[model samples]
Target: MRIAFLLALLAGGVYYTYVAFIDLNFLTRTGRLGPGFFPRSVGVMIVLLTIWALVDALKEGREAATNAGLWRDVAMLMVLAIIYAVALRVFGGFVATVLYLAVTLSVLNRGRPLQNALLSILVPVAVYLLFDRVLNASMPPGLIDILPI
Candidate 1:
């Protein structure tokens, strides 16, 4: 099952990388960064990491699948990611990221509320600053427009 999951991730990453490379330009007309820049980078990283994980899983063989708790954790994280993606549409980048990180950290990093809270707020702020201020790129706006961030 672990191998299967890794294989699926590798396949998805490959497809994402293919689309990023084929459908999007790496640079704008003026030679500045384009829309495809981040996606292409991310897609490449995903493909590489997934391939590494798949290789590791194949080496582990049947022994890795014996841990039901590990599978549960993987499933939970996947579900959280899906929720975060949906939340990005509804709450936009900053608020959705804050909420998603808070909930996800609470579940995955139990007994560390202080760390979780700090990360939940700080990471999103940093990302917002990186994209909106430093990069001069637009963040995804929410449908509801709750925070005015």
Candidate 2:
């Protein structure tokens, strides 16, 4: 697990570095700090943190192997993220977010249906109101376009 985590982190660091440096147009006269500055900083931090974690895991002498079901959690989260992404495109941000939250909560909390439902519905609605109504941000128009707010 430690090895896998380290490798993943390293890969992400490299990818982000590329995005921040190679792909970013830093030559523009947009100021001292270009669009890539933050990404590059983040990439550097990721690399450093991964290295630290790797060292810490090695020092523990436990092989970083645990039956804590980390992979399952990671998979569930990934699935939820994908669902949210796709749903945002089709169902719009509000509906997609609610569905994603509900599904994620249901999957994670297998025995709690009522709590999951309430949370899924209420959380998204709250976020929608905060961003769309209060902050004047745009959200996806869901199937029920009547309430674009």
In terms of TM-score, the best-performing candidate is 1
Candidate 1 clash pair list: none
Q: Candidate 1's error at 10, in angstroms? A: 16
Question: Residue by residue across 1-149, what tens digits does model 2's lDDT show?
Answer: 66787878888887888778887755458567677778888888888888888788777876745566887788769977987887787788877887888888888888999999999999988998898889998887766553444
Clashing pairs in 2: none
lDDT of 1 by residue, 1-149 (tens): 67778888889999999999999999999999998999999999999988888788777767523578987999999999999999999999999999999999999999999999999999999999999999999888899899997
Worst 10 residues of 2 by lDDT: 140-149
137: Cα error in model 2, Å: 1.1
Alpha carbon lDDT at 43, candidate 2: 82
Task: Tell me the TM-score of model 2.
Answer: 0.55
- Every candidate's lDDT: 0.92, 0.80
